[model samples]
Target: MQSIRDRLEIILSRLANRADEKVYTKLYSEAARAAADAADARQKAGVGLGLLDGAIVSIKDLFDVAGEPTAAGSLMLASAAPASRDAAVVRRLRQAGAVILGKTNMTEFAFTAIGDNLHYGTPGNAVDASLIPGGSSSGAAVAVAEGSSAISIGSDTGGSVRIPASLNGVVGFKPTARRVPLAGAFPLSMTLDSIGPLARSVTECALADAVMAGEDSAFLQPIALAGLRVGIPRGVLFDETQAEVASAFEGSIRKLEQSGARVADLAVDDLIAEMRAATKRGTIASMEGAEVHEDWLAAGASVPVDPHVSGPLSRALAIPASVYIRTIRRRTELAASMDERLASVDVLALPTTPMVAPSIAAMTGDEALRDKTEGLLLRNTQAANQFDLCAISLPMPGMILPAGLMLVARRGHDRHLLGIAAAVETLLGR
Candidate 1:
């Protein structure tokens, strides 16, 4: 096998233009080389070889890696004390024999779907430099797309992983909330936060997720497409979808149908409207997020929250306790309702995002436009989070610019979802 150290060197060399301080805020060169050396030594001794042995993996900045401050893509936490030990998942990754590349950048506190960060630079989309990479897992997705890592770990709350993966044309998996430990990562929404992997393929994500969960590699069984039922909601998710994105999504539906899968367009507006109402009622992330940052902000650990993030947090801080509690209850009710609605389908299908990646210029020039675009991007993927569903984003076919076809399954069915995704991926080709 190729030496792990050599692979790290090769990966780093490709990152020469990965958008400075954005995709990767830190590079654990010496530490990674040391780990790589150990892996190679173990190989020679015929021991210490695990599933991810010698693989290079990049971590989202939110993950706590011992001895490094988890800045979470903000300068506010830059001076925070180093972590005492690796986050549970990071420890698991190491145990799986992977080389920890470094911490990747993200939206400040992972508060936004858009990747822009005032403190740390934004990682430009690899598919289109002018575009804003989908985030708060922006750097994690870009790192994989840029070939800087074989796989990257990221946190998903409200479509963070799926949005970025869709925009970057890579596979993004958001397992059930409790599928992986959340002990070490900085919190965005305690209720919705999930840890998952973004990689070139579904099998890779499944393998990484298994290791992170401290479980044996899942046996991926492919479900035949002939009898598979893919549900495409007729409204809400498709509302305001750009022409190009809609075309790509429709094309994928056609392909699946031709491949023998039965595509059903269901009247899902009620379920979707309920999700939107939940957001309007109150955001769980913003509510819990305010609590999480209250101390730090009061002490001035984070002096000035980014405008985009501050708007929501400030409102959340003022949210009456009753409102927050009500919203939580409403969210649970909505999740149950949505899951129940999926009884007739094998999986839910929709565009991963409402549009192709928009130029960062368009977003930067008009504040209102930026807000609007970001909201649209989150429109589709956030449903899965709201419904507490396990979801994956796969690239759609014949796209000059990348678009994604998302597949969502009921929560707690992550492994089975991955298997279904793998079957779809195969139908679409690698």
Candidate 2:
């Protein structure tokens, strides 16, 4: 392999001629060059950091990088006070000797799953520029998919990271919410926010996730596929799933079965319905997000912000405090129930997004269509956040348009889930 510095130069050259501002909020070219040079020097001296040393990485815009305001894909906070220090994850990434490429674009306040940023402009899907790149980790996935970065760190609050990764045809992992510290990250929903990684392979995601979670950066060993129980939650989540995505997901399951994995239908539709009922007032994420952005919402019309973000937040704010409290309490009970229900299976498999990437022009042109599309996109993946589970989206092979086969495991089983994903990735010949 070429030296880290040389590889970085090639990536920079490729990006130099592209209009990538929509994909990257800010590029750390000077900082990246310095870090790459250091990594190269360390290599020459026969000294180096672990797995992440000399690796190029991109961060979602919500993370604070000392001396810069975390705009988080919004113009409203473009002039916000600069951060006094790097975010916890950012500091950790540096300590691991990872080269910081840039801050990738995201939905304003990480609110929407559609991935279009009116302020920073939207980043087109990595496979097809005209399609919506699934968000709020839009640029993070695009950066990795476009090979501008070796890996990308992104926040997953209600499917942001996995959705984009699925649409972009890459690996995206959402660890259990508390696995990684959230300090210095712009909050969307404190309750649901999780930091994770996107990369070309499951191993890269695992390594980056371990570093961010403050765990040992050791290579992951694939768990045996034989006799591992894989559950298929076959209900509302599968509703309206596009034909191509459905076919691809089914094909993936067949491949796993052929590899000696045990596959069965785990009936969780009732539990899903109950969970939905518990949050009828609003989801835990939207309710908590409203609280985080109270001042912004209070500023109302004076603050120019995306209506898609503000509208849902405004509605969530109107929900009675008592209702929000009841929902939170009920959610805890539901999450526990989900954990118990999942004990029979090693993991649950589903389509990451019910549909493939849709044209950005179509989404932007029709308001009703946009809302409907966003709901469909978030349906399957949001369950992991709602129930507090570790989930990963692996690109399904042989699809005309990219889609993800999501595998969800119980909370705090991030490492186990990554191992399973690695084994499955190999089975898929990815």
TM-score of 1: 0.96
lDDT of 1 by residue, 195-289 (tens): 99999999999889999887876678788889798888877678898888889888788888998989888777887777667668568888889
Tens digit per residue, CA lDDT, model 2, 94-146: 99999999999999999889999988899999899999999989999999999
User: lDDT of each model, Cα atoms only?
Assistant: 0.86, 0.92
lDDT of 2: 0.92
Please give each candidate's TM-score: 0.96, 0.98
For each of the candidates, give the backbone clash count: 0, 0
